[model samples]
Target chain A: MSGLRITTAAEGTTHRVVLTGELDHETAPELERTLARLPQAAGHRLVIDLSGLALCDSSGLTTFIVARERALAAGTGFELTAPPPPVSRMLRVTGLDRVLLARHPQDA
Target chain B: MSVAGHQVEEPEDREASFSALLEDSMEDLYDNAPCGYLSTLLDGEIAKVNATLLTWLGYRREDLVGRRSFADLLSVGGKLYHETHYAPMLRMHGEARELALDLVTADGHRLPVLVTATVKKNQDGDPLLVRITVFDARERRAYERELLRARREAERERERLQRLTSTLQRTLLPAELPEVLGLEIAAHYHAASSDQVGGDFYDVFPLDADRWGFFLGDVCGKGPQAAVLTSLTRYTLRAAAVHDTDPVAVLSTLNSVLRQRHDPGAPRFCTVVFGLLQPDGDDFAVSLASGGHPPPLVIRADGEVDVLTTPGGQLVGALPDAHFVATSARLTPGDVLVLYTDGLTEARRADGLMLGEDEERLPALAAGFAGTGARAVVDSLAEVLTAWADEPSDDTAILALGPRPPEAR
Candidate 1:
């Protein structure tokens, strides 16, 4: 079985989600649902930590984009942290790296 | 009196001993059954467990009998799932059958197992205890993992193949349409399917300082085979146009090359319209030749639409000496000349009517587009195509060329 683990930690107004696993079409929905359930209040910061993520596919990228859009609509800050090399390369190839990548919470 | 007493005593002692032996074996059978068995309190605390289960889990009776709940032995994900879904379902249904779970043994190893559990109730129907039976599922789990890996590998291979097809399709067409002096030009290519490369192609390039060559064509089929023919036809047309600017000569050259490469078992052919444009004052002198392709539509500067007739044409590369027809027209300022593949004409609407089958519909449609710039004409046609109920049934390539007004030039 493909292993996926999601752990959410809340620090004041910032919500950080750490992900570890292969994120393909099968598991992308799990991440989507997790993000969708997060509190969407103005000025709330949502950070996805990808330091432990081993793999990601196009569907996973789409989920991240959707989360970013939702955050923007809700007037919240959103960003991705420490995406693995493969995931970063995919974003670059699709020309979304600069638009979607946020190095720090303040940057977002 | 002594002999009767001895026989009676022996028979009574044997019957008592046989009854005690049967009672001892019944308890042993429950502990040594092939499958693991356990009984948990209503709250999932282990109340009693058999020897078979204790051995499989590598746990001593004292370590688990009243110490740990069943949920504690599961993996983190399994625990979460059990709490959120399994436990609630079991409570509502009173039984959960053949649930697959990963158990963490005392040695920290994972053991996949299939578990069946039922709630045992007292005579008053109040739930009293839960009984569970577990079967080792190592072999089944391994088989399932293999199947999943195979499916994932197949999907990856398919994605790679699609990327390759798209890259090859891009190489078959010009990177950008050539800009001719004093003329406005635009082009669009609509692919009927993304899974395979389409056979439609178009190009506009300078033939000389004073003239330009353009062509739009469709191969007989789709996919890799037709893709090969498309590339070959495009290269041959470009090379022939360089050698001779005559529209008919350019097509005849492609015809001979295709005929030479044709296989008898799987004959290949295409329909093409080759044209040459030369600047003439504030207009362009256009010479076009057709090989079993649709005629070009000229939307005049005064909002009059006319189909340039190039009759007596035959399908290219089908025969050694196929005939082609050449026609000439002058595209004045504000007059757009549109060249397209049969995909446009053959497109079927939701009601099953072909766009090209009704000649009146096409001319009437072009009438609305008369006096529009080349870019507008191409863009509007693309929009019209997108409005179809389904993707165009075939690859469609459209190229429009028109002269610029004197002030713009």
Candidate 2:
């Protein structure tokens, strides 16, 4: 069981990261610890590539929501891309797509 | 001679010794029974096990005593799950009871068993090694499988019953809308839920070609009684339309039939909108009679959307002479008339916000149509509804009549 490994890279003003393996109850704290260390830049966009994510329950979602709020408070753009079907569906069911400004804006 | 006389006393001693031997055998049963009995250190390691159990698993006392953990005995999936999820829970709660696991036997057969584990502690309530008990669950697994099969059969039976009811419910509506000249017409019904019956019904049939009679109604309550009223209203309207093309007179007859058939104590009433459409050359003129139903929505070719209010109309069957209000509209080319039940407006979102269909409805519809035909209108209406409702509605229905474009032929 591999814990979530977040690999970050800098592309000009945008901060891109990829999350891999399970994001769940006990392991969410580890993700938050990694998120807190990030430097905040005004208008910095955070694009999370979730293509390698295996599973995520409610705790993991709450972590993302909290992360999104922190980024938005600094007036920065935060968006996720390539979420697996399970995570994407959870976002849709919870109406996170509308709040987070996910892809396919017109449909939302 | 004296020693021979003491033989009875000797026999009593022998009986006492036999009882002592039985106690020794019982102690041996708990320690080295046919099944495994092992206690481990604070971290799972072989502490003690029955000789028979050791032989069955092909593990030596020296091989497992200080090295092998209980998790080591588990299959790969089970071991991984235990380390990631189960072990932590056990540490926090002091127990991991009746967890089903598979172990590799000496002959390489997967031995299925139910394991119960508990953490032992010292006087200071400190942690200790986990003590585990395993019970064979193959028979229980077979029993559970049988129960699952029975549950599936019961569910299938229920689905069949609902389908039959749905088919019977569908048969109670008109087969097709009568093709009224000089007008493009389309209608739809969106069921709030599939499991229960819906009383909302709509139809458009000719009161003799030139005059077309269309009715949309919601019978009070649900189930077979509402179904009965729906069937009665349709037949009575069809029969009365032949004699009287007047929309108000047609409803008056429906009122009488419902009043006569219903007992005074019974609750019987329905909201209906009956329209008489007549082609005046190339234009269409509609005279609508309403009985406590939502007024039709007119989406003009000019792209203006408004809810037509048909006030002062009484619900049918509730009054001796239900006062039906009559309103007239001249439908221009590219214009569409939508007569629907209140079900559409009343659908609740996840946040308990009722989707104000009349107000916020057009934007979604306008988006659905890239400025074109009735087909887009119908498709958009369904898409927006499924989006808003999220799931099948608690009680929602819609009926739209759109005019098609002339050029495509």
Candidate 3:
């Protein structure tokens, strides 16, 4: 029932986690646990595809930061692709997108 | 010799008694006056001060009569404030006028007080000594502090309430829009002012792989009552969609839910637009249901923006089984559909101009953003509103969903 999903792109080590649903106090911890499990990609990248995100709150923003930090410490690069515009703008203002790789266009 | 002696003695005795009475009255008046009484020498030395001020400060006269100057009884900051602010004013004025100050107590506490000093003059009209009066301001200071504390507490509570309301408000909307293949979703909610709560809401969710359910509504009021109705409307829409894909039936059920429980006498009302978004292999088909709400704005893949012309939707809960209007449209990749609350259209500028309703002005942003895609369109849409609503908006909310461009695939 958790809105978070983790799957490695089949051919590459690029771990792509697609986040769906609302991230609030109730569900943000679920993401923290999920992000902690992925393989340590020393040189590879982690892309969080947020195309499915409907609403983002403080808990959601914090979870992304935690995910980005974990990726950073692991020597893995963190990227967030396809953030819904509202979430994307919030990240921009909070300067989170600068830490995580953020591509505004959600499609590709 | 005896007569002269007796007469002289009587006058002397009379003079002595009268002088004694005069001295006693002076002491009594100085010690018990409503205001504090003190005299300082030219060098700022306390020569004599009354018992009234001593009592106000919980001090003994012996402690200050000759041992301490007036400045010794001031707090560190109060001392500095007096030196820099009060002293100059007092000196320049010859009588330091009513100056609010704090005098330290013997017990190491503070006394809020006001003091006024006047320079006494001799017969020659030369400055002789300074006499000061101290009035206890404990009651006034206490009252002012209490008022400040209450204001600060209320502000903190409002901020907490805004957060709580925002948290609850966010829950009322979809957490994440269901990712329909080849679709980009954009949403914005413009909080009016955090001072008070609002009833504006919007949402989009997945109904099926090829279809999605979305709506935007404005509840008529505020506070706990409106919040409860908002929750009911949101959950009912989500659950009712599962039971019926038809927008009208879903609204009908919502009307019944509102009618059954909520008091119509309280006059609760809401404007809502429910839509089922279906995508064909290459094109998208949308069916919309309206219940006394604003029409949805559609930006076509071809860069044309226009209001979807669905009208005559009845207010939900106003009447039992109120009729709702339904409409449809075809969507190609790059089509943007935006549903919003009246707050967006009704946003007023300081100049008193309002951003026209979606049906009128949405196309300006949509047309300009034709090639840029849904995210860009929504960004512009939100930006236009921000610029237009420089003043606080009542309760603006928007839900935008569009098909992804070929590159997004």
Q: Write the per-residue lDDT of candidate 2 for residues A4-95, one digit (tens) a residue.
A: 88899989878887889988756778877777667667878887888888766445665676677677767778887888775664444333
In candidate 1, stretches whose alpha carbon ends up further than 4 angstroms from where it belongs are A1-108, B1-35, B50-52
Tens-digit lDDT string for candidate 1 (A1-108)? 576799999999999999998776678888889999999889899998988877675457657766877787799899888887766644443334555678556656
- The window of 10 residues in a row where model 3 chain B has the poorest summed lDDT is B352-361
- TM-score to true structure, per model: 0.70, 0.55, 0.69
For residue B86, model 1's alpha carbon misses the true position, in angstroms, by 1.3
TM-score of chain A of each: 0.90, 0.88, 0.80
Q: Per-residue alpha-carbon lDDT of model 3 for B1-409, expressed as tens digits? A: 2775574457878898888777467778889888888888766678898888888888888888877877888889878987897768766777787777889898989998888888888998778878888999999899989999999999999889888877877777667766667778888777775654568777788886566888889776666767787888989988999999999998888888887864422545577888898877766788988886767777877778767754446767655546777888877787888787767665667764556523346557657777566677767878888888776547778777777767768
- In candidate 3, which residue pairs get closer than 3 Å at backbone N, Cα or C atoms, i.e. clash? A53-B176, A54-B175, A54-B176, A54-B177, A55-B175, A107-B408, B90-B96, B182-B404, B292-B313
Cα-based lDDT at residue A76, candidate 1: 88
True-vs-predicted CA distance for residue A99, candidate 3, Å: 56
Let me know the TM-score candidate 2 reaches against the reference structure.
0.55
